[model samples]
Target: MKKILVLGAGYVAQPLVNYLLKNTQFELVVADVHLEQAERVSGNRARTQAVSLDIRENEKLEQLIEQTDLAISLLPYTLHLQIAKACIKFRTPLITASYVTPEIRKLDTEAKEAGIVILKEMGLDPGIDHMSAMQVIDKIKADGGKISSFKSYCGGLAAPEANTNPWRYKFSWSPKGVLLAAQNGAKFFDKNQIVDVENDRMWEQTWPLQVDKFNLEAYPNRDSLPYISRYKLEGIETLVRCTLRFPGWVKTMAALREIGFFDSESQKSAEKLSRDKLLRQLLHIPNGTGLRQIFKERAGQFWTEEIEERFDWLGLFENTPENRHNENTSAIDFLVSLMIEKMSFAKNERDMVVLHHDFIYEKAGIRHNWLSSLIEYGRPDGTSAMARTVAYPAAIAARFILEGTINLSGVQIPVLPQIYNPVLQELTNQGIHFSDINKKI
Candidate 1:
């Protein structure tokens, strides 16, 4: 069995460590900045070793790599370039959950020269979403269909019963990354045109969608146009979109935007306040302050009443007594900490991932619609859909590398049938499957 070393001990890392510890023959070594986390996952397994170290230390990483064959990184996205550099230098294959960074992309030839596989974007959005969308596109094209427009929306949400919070959002995953994406607007293709924006411009045309009695308002999330080129839809003029939201989410998000929660720019008082302090100040804005108060105090007001209502309904406004010292903080800052506060799953409340995709295409002058939705609930073992969607695809990619299923070396994203078929099937078998229904376009 090949020896694999995994870096990081966060949510994604835990599921991965658990998966490898049980299923694979690979000798796994788990490393983390938090020794207890590494220890918790490693236990007493003979093939597993847990340790604390500054991974940026080149000499130490080199020492660990002496006995390691495959390096799996679950580190934050920014660390990918440095990790990729190390993998290339060591002639070791590395797989990460991050999107392909420009620096890492530039190393394709060097990695290929070193005979090392550097796979990226194999996690949730860039991972499963890419593979699944490609598979669907391939099927549509193969079936004599001309692609028209495509939209994919996936969100890791707290189940209704478990979602006591107003935003219906919780940080079962990374908080910083979540904030970054939410701050960044949705990008997509629409009206036979390619478009990208930070707001619910897609909700202007709401397609009523019903699945298992769950009604959702569809909107686009990121740059959906590139997928046309990436998925090889040359003959077709297509609009693509992806969204992340809860029911009636667009209006609430719009309210937030009206209140200014989407701003990534440094605030006017940021020079006097650190990021944390700025966040605290934002949270300190009272419930009834309204726009005049926001404009008077902060530079903007982008959040909505729904968010405030959610907070009030969730009892987030009440004094927990535990966090009582923070009376003057902003709701956003309080939310930041609150997310992490209950990020882990409760024993009875399940976490779920809802992934919805709509592909509009034409075949033989017939306009046809294909709608696919995937819903995966949290494991009884305390894993969230966020972790599963992110980690499983990554592990599958690693499996391909270990089993010699994907041998073309270089920096790459998983889009091929060889990469998608087995992983998708396995994921389906493991409670991740998409249901497709035909409709008139």
Candidate 2:
């Protein structure tokens, strides 16, 4: 039997691990720094083993890769290159849900030369989003049509029934990732012109988006220009990929940033500081100034009752003992900590995943619009929608690679039809499908 090594057993790893184990006869090894977490995911399956592994320990990581026919990395994106290098050394196929960075792309020729495939961006947004969009774009092209505009948006959120928090959001993944994304600038094409949004102005660029019954907000996500080329949309008038959130999210995040919550430069010198003191320092409030007053003075017209209530709910004004410790944490870290404590999903609470894509194209001398959307919810007290959507595509891709259905070698993504068609079909079979609404304009 073939062997597969899965690195990093995080929240999203469970679905991928279970899917492979149930569907394939391969011997699977799940590795993590916390061996218990891996073991828990393994579930004492016959062909599965869980081991303690610090990916930073190069020898141990390489040894595991050498023994496996394929390696799936669920580790942080920063460590993917190291894992890729090891996979190359061992001539093992590699799969990851992370985006392909420049460094990772540089390995393409080498990976192809080694007769091994390095597939990246096989998760939710980059994974299903790409596959779903390409399926339509290619069909449009095949029908003698030209895409004029393409816009896509996605989000992980609290299901409507579970929306009990002020933020209308919950952490289905890393809290730090959510905070860090707010600090990212974005670039995309609009009417064939390049539009760049600076980090500070990212929130300001959002507009209301109506996805079915939900009134959400959309903000550009990272650089979308590269995707124009990636999607082969050479003369498109507009191309943008955006993140979706509740209506008030942009304004709240903007206020948080203005208050210096996203600042990573400031460090805590003291061993401990009360929440009020921490807030005062971060917001630059005077010794005698109250957080409420200072917030109004700095935020001016931007301050709202909703925003103040969010802060209050987070206990930013309270001297809670839990918020007293200073592990030399930065402003971002502190904010992330508060969010993790407040916004985490509770047992039996369901999370939702929303993916919507709009394709504007001209066919047979008539303009047409195609809107494709996928909305999935988690099973209460069971597998999360975020985990399933993110992990399922990668798991399906891994199965294809192992079964010789996907025979391409080199660094790649699930863009081409051969890669996307079967994957999309299988995803549909597994209850992860997109619905398309087309209209002539």
Candidate 3:
């Protein structure tokens, strides 16, 4: 029997673990730094073993990889390279939902020589987004269409019924990932011109958007210029990739960022500081002065009723007890902690994932405007939409690799037809599918 190792049994691992166990006969080893988490994911099921593993232990990681036919890394992107090296040494194929960073791409030749595939970006935004868009792009070209403009937006948000918080958001995946993404600058093509957005001005580029019946806003996600070649859309007049959030998110995030709340520097004295004290420090307010009063005076344009309400709702102005656990954590760490505490989904609360693509093309002298959109909701059984969408694609791809259905070796993503076609068909079978609508204008 083939052995498959799953590294990092975090929020999304449950779906991937469950899907593999249900669909394949492979013996699974679910490992994480936390024994409890690994055991929780494996569920003592037959053909599964749960083990605690600190991935930093190189020898131990190699020992595990050497025994497995394939290793699926769900670890943070920073750790992916370490995992990749181990897999290459063992001649074991590896798959991940993380983006293929330049450093990872550098492993392509080594991976090819080893005769093993290193597939990355097999998750929702990077995974399904790539597969779905490429499917449409390939179809358009085959139909003799000339692509003009392409815009894509994706987001994981609280379902309307579960949108109870003032933020209209909940953590279905990594909170730190969301915080880190806010620090990115973005670049994209607009009407044949390149537009660069600095990190500080990212929120300023947001625009309102409507997907299906829900209203949302979008801001550039990150450097999108590289995708012009990846998607084979050279010379396209416009190409933009963005992230979506409910109406007030951009304003709240911009205000917090401007207030030094997103600062990545660690504070040695943070262990003794409570939220109110930190708030006072950020706003330069004196002790005994009302936080609202000083905030209004110092915030200038950022001070708004809604922003203040969101801040107050987060308990940032409360004289709460200091968290001694903070130790040397940074301001952004505190923000992530607070969001996890305040914005996490409650039992039975559903989360939503939305991916929308807007395309303009010319075919036979007629211009066509097309939209491909997908909306998925978390199950009532407490399985999150984020987990399902992010995990299933990777899991399905892993199955194909195990079955020799995807035999190509080297660093890869799901953009190619062989990878996207079968994976997308299975995704539809799993009830995660996109709807495409087109019109002539």
Candidate 4:
């Protein structure tokens, strides 16, 4: 059996751990800073250990890589370089959820030389969204049509009923990372002309979107135009990449931005606090067992008084003299955290992964429109939508790699037809399929 090692244990990590343990033929080993979390998720079915990945020690990393056939990093995007180096050193295949940063892209040449595979963007957006959208884009192109533009969007959200907080969000995953990402407001892109939305300008933009049965809102999360070359779209003129959000979320986010939630111009105060105190101040949100009791007159269950109180005591949301009214994390981070709590899948209520794709193409001198999307709501705690959506693609990709169905190596992605078509086809066979809707020109 193939030996697989997974790093980091978070909302995304749990699903990956559970899936590998129960389904695949691989012997799983999970390493986290927190040993209890690793054990809690893996039980005795898989190997669970505790290790600090904070400071990179090349030899130790190589040993782990030497031990496992594959290493799936559920860690931060920033940690990719170290992980990538370790993978290359041990000639082990690798995968991660981070966007392929330029530094990472540079490793492509080295990874290829090493004859090892490194797969990035294997999570939800970069994971399922990329492959799913490409599948449709390629299919439409083959039908003999001139593509006008492409806009793709995806979001991890909480169930509707659970959205009852001031921010309508929660901390399903890493709150600090979420807090840090918002400062990446603008990017340089080559869509038509040079496009730039820097600093606070990022919060100023909003786009409207609709995919079959759902109404949605979106905002550009990162660079979009570069994908034209990556996706091999030669003549595509207009394209935009966006992040999805519930209604009214944008305005509230904008207000938070206007108030300095997006500001990372200063962090001296934050640097002065002890780690525990700093985290406490940063996560000090008001929370309670009973929204009616703790919040009583506060907001909703999205974050009851007890929850806020914990956050306050813990230093997440509430304002306190101890907090010192300083910005410990980014507003977008806080917002994403807030959304996680609000949107997380529950024991009974199901969680869904929705990927909406809209394509416009011209054929026979006629312009036409086609809107396609895939909606996969997860089973529950035992089998979540997040897990299924995330795990399916990786599991499918791994099988293809192991079975020799997919043969190219190097720093790779899900842009190829062989990878997506069969993989998506398999997902469809398992009740994960995208729908196509066509309208007159």
Number of backbone collisions per candidate = 26, 0, 0, 38
Instruction: Write one digit per residue (lDDT tens) for candidate 4, span 1-441.
Output: 777777876556666666565545667777767767666656666444445444266676677789987888877788889889888878888878778888988898889888888888876678777887787777778988777777777775655655454444444445555545555564433355546787456546666676555566777767776787887776776677777766555554443444344444333253444434433333332333432233222323233344444344433434323332455464345445544554344566555566776667887888878777777775644566666777667766665666568776688888888777777787787688878886757
Candidate achieving the largest TM-score: 2
RMSD of 3: 1.9
Q: Per-residue lDDT tens digits of candidate 3, residues 1-441?
A: 778899999989999988898755788999999999999999999999999999889999999999999999999899999999889998999999999988999999999999999999999989999999999999999999999999999999999999987777888755887877777889999999999999877767889999999999999988899999999998899999999999877767767776667777776553567767765554445799787676665556667888888878988778887754446767787777888888888889999999999999999999999899999999978888889999999999989999988898999998999999999999999999999999998
Q: Summarize candidate 1's per-residue lDDT along 1-441 as a digit string, tens digits.
A: 788888887778877776776655777888888889888877758788898868778778777766688888988888778778888888989998787777889999999999998988888887888888889888988989888677677777777677766566666655656654555555565666655564445446445555555665565655666666777876555555555556656655455445555544432342444333444345445444543345334423334455556544544444333333424444444455665665545576778787877788989899998888888888776777778889888877776678788776898888888788888887887677888787875
Deviation from native of the Cα of residue 329 in model 1, angstroms: 8.0
- Rank the candidate models, highest lDDT first: 3, 2, 1, 4
lDDT of 2 by residue, 1-441 (tens): 889999989898889988898765788999999999999989888999999999889999999999999999998999999999999999999999899999999999999999999999999988999999999999999999999999999999899988987777889666888888877899999998999999867767899988888889999999999998899999999999999999888778778777777878665546466677776666566689677787776665567999888888887778865444545667787788888888898888899999999999999899999999999999855899999998998888889999988889899998999899999999999998988899999
Comparison by TM-score, 3 against 4, better one = 3
Off by over 4 Å in 4: 22-24, 46-55, 186-194, 262-350, 382-384
Provide the lDDT at 264 for model 3: 75
User: What would the C-alpha RMSD of candidate 1 be, to one decimal place?
Assistant: 4.7
List runs of model 3 lying over 4 Å from the truth.
Answer: 268-274, 281-289, 323-326
lDDT scores of the candidates, listed in order? 0.70, 0.88, 0.89, 0.65
Which of the two candidates, 1 or 2, achieves a greater lDDT against the reference?
2
Instruction: Please report, as a residue range, the 10-residue window in candidate 2 with the lowest summed lDDT.
Output: 320-329
